[model samples]
Target chain A: MSHQFYSIECIIPPHIQNNIAEKGTPEQRKKVMGSISQSAAIRAQRVLLTETKALVEPVTVGGKQRNIFNLNFGSNLPGILARSEGAPPTGDPAVDEAYEGAGATYDLYQQEYQRESIDGKGMRLDSTVHYMKGYDNAFWNGRQMVYGDGDEDLPEPQRIFNRFTIALDIIGHELTHGVTQFEAGLVYRDQSGALNESFSDVFGSLVKQRQRNQTAAEADWIIGEGLLSPNINGIGIRSMKAPGTAYNDPLLGKDPQPAHMSDYKTIDYDNGGVHINSGIPNHAFYATAMEMGGYAWQKAGQIWYVTLRDRLTSTSVFADAAQQTYLVAGNLFGGGSLEQQAVRAGWQAVGIQIDAGDSGGNGGGTGGDTGSGGGTTSPGCSTALVQLLDNVKALIENRSR
Target chain B: MKISYRRTGGFAGMLISHSFDTDTLPKTDAEELVKLVSAADFFALPSKITATGADQFQYTLTVETAEQQHTLEVGETSAPENLRPLLEKLRLLARGKPDL
Candidate 1:
C-alpha cells in the first residue's frame, strides 16, 4: 500500500482493530492486521513527534474554537460567516445561541471528561443557523452543525417548533453525533442506531445539567426544553426522565419512545425506530445518573464516555452497551463498588440484567436479546471496517465529483 | 389518483403527513401536482434510500393511480436531485394540513 493509504488506515483506533480481528471476514481481518502491523512500526516516531510538539506548544493549544454562520433562509450550508470565536456576539439570537451552546458543550467534555473537543483532537466547532424558511430540524451533517428556523416563518398559532438553537441540550446532542462519528462509528440503523442516539441524549442532558449547575436530581432531564412553542401541548422533544410523555398534541403526534425492553419498538420508519427504542437506554442513563447523585457529568457521564470511546464497536448492541458499561464502572470504581451497583441497577430498571459473573466475556448472555439484538457476535465482515471503507469511498467519490 | 406524503425522524421526532386525491383538488393544482410527479420520475426511484447522518429527516412518499401504486422511503442526505422539488412541494402541502 502507499504511505498515504497506511496513514489513513492507521488512524483506525486500536480497539476497533481488535473488534475487526474478532468479528471480521478473513479478507477484512487480513487487511486490518496488516495495517496494524505497519502502524506499530511508525507508532514510536509519531509519539515522539507528538511529545516534541506538545513541549513546544502552549498548554491551551487545543482551546475551544467556534465559528457560527447564517444560511439566511437558504439550504446552502455555512452560508455567511456571522460570528467567530472570542468575537463580539452579533445580536442575532440563533447565531449567539449556537455559539454559546457550542461553548457549553465543549466545556462539559473538556472539564469533566478531559476531552479536547468533539473529536478529542481539538476539532473546531462550526454551526450554521436559519437553514431554510420554516424548516423544523437540526442535524450534524457529518462535518458541522446545521440548525433550522423551526416554523418561525409561520403564524404563531400554526407554529410547532421554536428556533433549533433555542435549547442547549439540542446543540449538545447534535455535536455529540460528531463525537460518535469519530469514536464508535456506530451503524446508523437498528439496535446500534438506538445506542448511538442514547449516548447523544446522555451527554446532551449532562451538558444542560452542567451548564445550569444542577445536580442530577434537580435537572429536568428534558432533551429540548423550551424548543416547543407555548401553543404546542408539549414540554419538549424527548424527556429522558420519562421518555414517552414529552409531548402529546393535536398537531404533532405523541412521542413514541418506550422506557423498557418489553416495549422496544420494531417499526420500519425512523431507521428501525432509532428515536423510539432509544427511550430504553435513555431512561437507563437517567436512572444511573439519579442513582449516582451529584453532578451527572462526574460519575455516570464518565462511565458512559469511557464506554463510548474505548469499549464500543460500530455494531455493538444494547446488551453490549449494558455489559460494557457495567464492566467500565467496575473498572473505574472497583468491583462491587456503589458505582458499579448503580450501573447494574440502571440497566436492570430498563429490563436488561447485567450478568454479574460474565466478567466481560467474549459474547452471549449478558442479557436476553431485546429484539434485533446480538450485533457484536454476528458473523460477517466487521461492520466498522465496512463502514470505514464506505466512508473512504464516499470521500473519494465526492472529491472526484 | 391519490398521493400521500409523511415525514418523520428529525431532531424533534415529530411525524407530519398529508394525503390528497386528484379529484379533490382544483384542476390547475391537480395538473401541477401531476407535472411534478412526472418531472421527478417518482415511480422509478428506489423504494428505500438511506445515508449516514444523525437527526436528518426521513420521508415517505406514496403515489397511487388506477394501474399501480408506489412508495419510497429516503433520508434527506440520500434524496435524489430530481426528487427534491417534489419533496419540498409535498412538505409545504403537508404543513398546511392539520397534523395526521
Candidate 2:
C-alpha cells in the first residue's frame, strides 16, 4: 500500500504507439511522447526493483480503511512473476501501474460500495508485472485479472493513431468484471453480456473520475483517452462521452460500436457480440446522465446502481433492462418521478422500450427502427434524444474499472 | 505418446507451447489427461470470430514430456480443478482475453 502505484505502466501494443505517432496536433504528440517515456521508464525500473528486495507495509490513510494491494495475478503467462499483496513495486513503471491500478480498483470498490473484495468474499488480489514483456491488452480473466504489454499482432495496432497501454480506464473496466460477477452475473454473451460490459464501463470511468477528484461536470468523460500509445489518430479506449467518437482513424476503422439498437451489430464474439454490441447500452447511460446533469454519482449513479442491483438479471435483454430501470425509477424515486420518465425516454431514444411497444413508437421490433416513424411532429425530439444520449453515457461511465 | 493441439492464432502468430517430463503417468492416466484437456474448452472460440477467438477460459493441460503428448481445449469446463483454466490463460500472454 505504501509503494507509489503510478511509477509503472503496462507494455503498450506497438500499434497504439504508431497511432499516437501520427497525430496532427503537437500537444497530442507531446502527451503521447511523455506517456511513452514514463511508461518505458517504469518498465525499466520494475526490472531493477524485481531484483531488489523490500518489505511492503500496510497503508491505512485517507478514506481507505482496508488494506488491498496492486492485486492482478498475471494469468499464468510464461516467465511472468506473480506479485504478493503490499509488495513494493520493482521500480518498474508498468509493474507499478498494474499494482497501482489494482490498488485503485480495490479501493474504489471497498470505499464506495462497502464491498469486501471483488468477490465480496475477501478473495486475495494478486497481480503480475511485466506481463508478456510487450503485451498490448488487459482483461479480467474470471479468476483474476491480467495485463499485456502490447498487442504486437494486429495490423491496425502498432501504426495506428492510438497505441495500447494499461491505462486507468482499462484497469477500471477489468475490475468491474468482478463486480458484475457478484451482482447480476450477466451472461457473457449477447444482450446480457453487453450489459455486463456496460456496467464495467460505467464504474470504470467513475474510478478514474473519483481518483482525479473531478466532479462529473469537470470530468473529461472519455475512457482510456490517455492510455493508448501515441500513434493512432483517435481518442482513448472507448468514448463514453461520445460513444462512437472514441476513434476515427483510417487504419483502426470505426469504433464498430453503434450507439443505438437499430445499429446494434449482432456478432458472435463475446457471446453474440457482447463486447461489440455494448455500445448501445453504453451510449444510453451516457445520454441519461447528460440529460440529468450535475454530479452523476448523486442522482444518476444511485439510480443505475439500484437498477443494477434490483432490476437487472443475468439474462435481461436490452428492452427488458430498459423496462427494469424504468420500473425501478418509479419504485425507488416514486411514481411518475423525473427519474422514471427520463429512464423511459432514454430507452426510447436508443430504439428500446420500457414497458410498451418498440423504440420506433408502435412500429415494433425487427422493423428498420429509426425516427422515420415520426413522433407526430414534436419539437422535443432532438432535445430529448441528446439528453438521453448523455444520460446513457454517464451511467456507463460510472461503472468503469 | 503423441498428443494433438491446435491453439488459436495469437497476437504474435506464435503457438503457446508447454513441455514436461512425466514418467509416472499410467496409460489410462495419459488418456484421461488428453480427454480432460481437450474437454476443458479454455479458449471458447466462437465460430463467427475470424479475427480472434473468445479469450475467456477455464482450461487444463496435460503434456507428457517423455511421451511428447499435449492436449488443449477451449470453452466449457469438464472439471473445476482441471488444468484447462490455467493452461488456457498461460497461452494468452497475460493480455486479458478470458480467465482461466
Best by TM-score: 1
Question: What TM-score should be assigned to candidate 1?
Answer: 0.78
RMSD values, in order shown: 9.7, 19.4
Q: What is candidate 2's fraction of native contacts?
A: 0.02
Candidate lDDT (C-alpha), each: 0.78, 0.50
lDDT of 2 at A147: 57
**Tens-digit per-residue lDDT, A1-401, candidate 1:** 13222223323333234344545777876576445433332333333444444344322336899999998987766699999999998999999999999999999999888999877778789899998777888998777899998888788987877998999999999999988877777777888889989998999888889989999999999989899899888999899999999988877778889999999988877778888899999999999888999988999999999989866777777877887788677556654667878999999999999867522222222321211132322223244345555655664575579
Predicted model with the maximum DockQ: 1
Q: What is the TM-score of each predicted model, taking all chains together? A: 0.78, 0.57
Per-residue lDDT of candidate 2, residues B1-100 (tens digit): 3333333222111122333222444566556555644564423423222211122432234444453444444442222344434443344322323211
Runs of candidate 2 exceeding 4 Å displacement: A1-90, A151-165, A356-401, B1-100
